[model samples]
Target: MILEIQNLHKVYNNGTHALKGVSFSVKEGEFLVVIGLSGSGKSTLLRSINRLIEPTSGTVRFLGKDITHIKGEELRKIKSQIGMVFQQFNLIKRRSVLSNVINGKLGSLGTFNSIIEKYSDEVYKEAYNCLDIVGIGDKAKVRSDSLSGGQQQRVAIARSLMQNPKLLLADEPVASLDPATSNSIMQYFERINKDFGTTVICNLHFLSLVRRYATRVIALKAGEIIYEGAPSDINEAWFKTIYGEEAEEVEIR
Candidate 1:
């Protein structure tokens, strides 16, 4: 197993219970999709795994190490090994795509040094390679904000790959895009999972994308795991059970 979560739980300061003893294991190179309604602890769950939002109580074991409370350099080390993609497509708008991708090593290079550092030819090559992987090698010299929404998201993915992370966490990665663009953005993740052997744990709201891209599915409701199985197994009865009886199925395409 690449990751193991044993009896995880989280509660916010506002007194809302976010995650209720959620536990699951992930194998290496598996594309696992998380499905749930808004405020169902999907975002919280992803943040907790990377320690962006600490869990109220639980164990997050990655590569056989318990990373629930590690701090300082240790925490930074673990985080550097994990890449995260946000719904907002986090990127330095004023910077070039190549520069943003090179920033992926900021953690290892130290923030202070990164600001003044001069990258070598090898570093530039790697950044261009990452751009090529996302089908945006030609956009490297362009300002990040100048790219289209889908293209900007691709730049973010390229930046994440510069770290050569063992695992990638995508939180509502394509929620802001159109149906066609949503699938296009998702294909990059699928390619990364297959070609680079990176384990992906993505939070997705669209069942269509989940069925098309996810190898396995886990559904959450009110911070609890309601279902776990193959995407093909999410039949009509199971849909209502996961999304509630009154919820209507909406296809993206």
Candidate 2:
């Protein structure tokens, strides 16, 4: 397994119980999609996995090592092997696209080199290669804030790829995109997952996209896993159970 979560729980200081004893395991190279409504703890679960939110309780094991409580260098080392893409592009707006992508490897570049922005030749090559993977190599010199939403998102994916991660976590990555752009963005993720053999754990709202891309699906409701199976098995009854009786499935395409 590439990732293992055992009884993971997260209760914010505001008394918001986000994740309630969630447990699951992800195999290497599996494209797993997490589905749920707003406030279902999907974001919390992804953030907790990367220790971004700091889970209140339970354990997270990545590559056979417990990383729930590790700090400083240990945590940094583990995080370097796991890349994350968020709903927002999260790029350095004023910087060039290539610069933004190169920042992904800053964690491993040592404090002095990163502070000086003294990237090596190999790093630049890799950044361009990553951009090419996302089909945005030609936009390397353009300002990030000047690109369209979809283009900026492509830059974000390229940035994440610079980590050479074994596992990639995407929290509603295509949420802000239109239907067509969303599909295109998803295709990039699919390509990365298939060609690079990277494990993917993505949070999504559209069942159509999930069924089209995911190898396995996990439905979350109020911080709990209501269903876990192949996307094809999410029948109408199961959909209502997962999304509530009043909820109707919405297709992206």
Candidate 3:
């Protein structure tokens, strides 16, 4: 398993129970999508994988190593193996796309060198290569904020690829894009999984987009997994089980 999340639970200091006994495993080259409403714990689940949000209980073992209890340098080193993308693009608005992409490798570089912007030629080359893979190579010199929502998300994807991670976690990656652009971005994610053997886990609000891209789907509600199965086996009834009366409120198409 690329990732093994066993009996995971997270409760915030403020007493918000984010995840409850969540358990799942992700395989190499798999494209998995998580669907849930705003407060359903999808973001928490994905962030917990990289320890951006630590679990209060349970083990998260990656490549046969338990990373849950590890801290400091050890934790940072392990987290570098996982890449994360977010809904907001999260790019430095003042920086060029290439600069933001290169920042992905900062975790692997010495602090002073990284802080001083002294990236090696190899790092720069790899950053540009990732941009090419994400179909944004031509925008390398442009400011990240100057791009459209879809293009900025692509730049963020390229930034994640620069880390050379084994697993990719995206939290509402295309939430800000239009339908057509969202489809294209999801296709790029699929291509990354198929061609690079990268494990992808994305949190999405769109059931149709999830069905179109994910091989496996996980549905969460009130911090619990209400459904877990192949995409083909999921339907409106399953959504109702997860969403209840609010099921009708969501626009899946």
Candidate 3, residue 28: how far the Cα is off, in Å = 1.7
Off by over 4 Å in 2: none
Choose 2 or 3, whichever is better by TM-score.
2
- The best candidate in terms of TM-score: 2
Q: What is the lDDT of residue 223 in candidate 2?
A: 97
**What digit string (tens of lDDT, one per residue) describes model 1 on residues 136-160?**
9998899999999899899999989
For residue 235, model 2's alpha carbon misses the true position, in angstroms, by 1.0
Please provide, for model 3 over 1-253, each residue's C-alpha lDDT reduced to its tens digit, 9 standing for 90 to 100. 8889999999999999999999989888889999888989999998888989779999999888998878999999888899999999999999999999998898899999988888889998999899999888999999889999999999989989988989999999988888889989998899999998899999988878887889999999888888889988877688778767566734444
Question: What is the model-wide C-alpha lDDT for candidate 1?
Answer: 0.93
Which residue segments of model 1 deviate by more than 4 Å?
none
**Candidate 3 off by > 4 Å:** 249-253
Model 3 clashing residue pairs (backbone): none
**Full-model lDDT for every candidate:** 0.93, 0.94, 0.89
Higher-scoring candidate on TM-score, 1 or 3: 1
TM-score versus the correct structure, for each prediction: 0.97, 0.98, 0.96
lDDT-based ranking, best first? 2, 1, 3
